[model samples]
Target: MTPSQNFFSDIHSIISQARQNAVRSVNFERVVMYWKIGQRIFEEEQNGEQRAEYGSFLIKTLAEALEPEFGTGFSARQLERFRQFYRTFPIASALRTEFSWTHYKLMLSIDNEDKRAFYEAESIHNLWNARELERQINSQLYERLLLSNDKKAVLAVAKKERLPEKAEHIIKDPMVLEFLGLKQESNYYEQDLESAIISHLQEFLLELGNGFAFVARQKRIHLDGDDFFIDLVFYNRLLQCFVLIEIKTHKLTHQDMGQLQMYVNYYDRVEKADFEKPTIGILLCADKNNTVVKFSLPEDNKQIIASKYELYLPSEKQLLEELEREINKEKD
Candidate 1:
């Protein structure tokens, strides 16, 4: 390279390295400061006889003092949160540098320790920002994981650093398709649905869960002079496989499964590299006959899957009933 090019490259490297160090230094300082603040506030609250009243007064007084000087972050509610943060994660050394104080603030709201830890570990591992962390938490990622896998598997997948074995580890069923904005009674063609999903691809990916990168929409595959267009194609880095999704506006049929199987086979035979795992096919339909799905695929089927989607969140009563039915089925 030219002298000028080398000089510029060196300057760029120096700037980049400096910026990274500055960020790390600032984050470490802030985490330490917050831990100390939390400790002080907690200790002051506990020292006096009117501890309960003092806790309330302490946050309010601190907020009053800090907000005018430091700005919007130090509201009474947030002060309380910082105190709770200290209570939840006592050790300053244990604070994750990957996340900011804002991220921890959001996590403190999660009542369940296990659920909070799972989100923390996953967020740090995935390098998620505060907003992404909040979205995943509000999206009920933990609940969806529980529904999809056994508790042991869920814990292992979320807590362990290793990638999960199957696509099911990261894929969520009955994925919330609220972003499509299609009303319950609105009639939409397959193309229309495809367009909606593409337009709202980011939200859809979030609902699809982690590690899915969009490869194509209306992805075409050619074989033996015939052309087939899969509705959606995604690559799951965690599973090390291609995911072929076929969208259906109506109840799933045997034909739908067969067609998805063909697409999966084509990908496995042609598109996939020797090092990549076998392709997975998912049928996203309005409804599915579980019995038919169980029997439709081969007895040893390990890739193809059919799952129903919902336009909006189901009612609490409906979810409870579904839970009860699942429990009863297991009992039988």
Candidate 2:
């Protein structure tokens, strides 16, 4: 590539940066304005405690006045959202300027305070757009983490207050891969799914969870003149470990677990340096039976995981049901 000092390229880069910066400035102002509107409404509500109906009336009157002068952005519903936004983020100085009002609006739809705050912080850290934020929420990223970690601690990790220590803390079960666009049919080969994952590597990394950097696809290994391959290998910087992942197009079995364990052992013995954490192995399969997996690995095993993978994103209702089942099972 030519040096950026080349005339046309330099002009292009300068104009692009200027436009991007301008958009960010406008977005920051818009977000702050909404925050202030919420603050104003909150203050008014606080002062009118005597009138039970004042809150509703205040919003209606404000919307009526503002919508005509401004636009639909000030609709009563939108104003109420602004009010809730202020309530959620009481500290204006702490608001994340990296996100636009659109991102905050989507985040506000999450009713849980910790979950909302976690998503907000993660978006700023990950540089996710509104769509990506919505996707992570819809996919229950928080809930998935909550499965392997304490609620408070998981929220802390999401907020960057603390880092994950183990592979379990960052891995997602039944990983969502709707971006691959593969049909839900059972005829696809393992290589096909591996190829799709490689093709959509960025999306795959996002679904794989945080701090994951892809190492290789179908990483080859040889032992005693025989060859073997691992479908995917990722390194999690947060955990400081090699995550060796084997993809199975069908349900996972003991043989699969054994194979992955061997790969994990290989990496721990040969690939990783002395200062790095022990390698972790994951069997990413279409299906997993908990009883079989439990019996397959040693009772105290900490380095092997068998997680199911999904070809499509589940609907909200379906995700809720699955989450409830997981919660109940965990309780048991």
Best by lDDT: 2
Q: Tell me the tens digit of each residue's lDDT in model 1 across 157-264.
A: 777755787776777766767668888778888788889999998888877766889998888888789998999999988788999999999999999999999999
Shift in Å, residue 267, candidate 2: 1.1
The lowest-lDDT stretch of 10 consecutive residues in candidate 2 is 142-151
TM-score for each model = 0.80, 0.93
Instruction: Score candidate 2 by TM-score against the native.
Output: 0.93
Name the lDDT value of residue 329 in candidate 2. Answer: 76
After TM-score superposition, what is the CA distance of residue 332 in candidate 2 from its true location, in Å? Answer: 4.9
**Reference-based lDDT, each prediction:** 0.82, 0.86
| Per-candidate clash tally | 0, 0
Residues 1-332, candidate 2: write the lDDT tens digits. 67556788889999999999999999989999999999999899888866558999999999999998899989999999999989988898988767888898898888887888788878877889988998998887887666566778877777788787667777887788889999988589889999999999999888887889998888898989999988889998889899998888888899999999999999998899999999999888999888799999998899999888877777767766777887787678
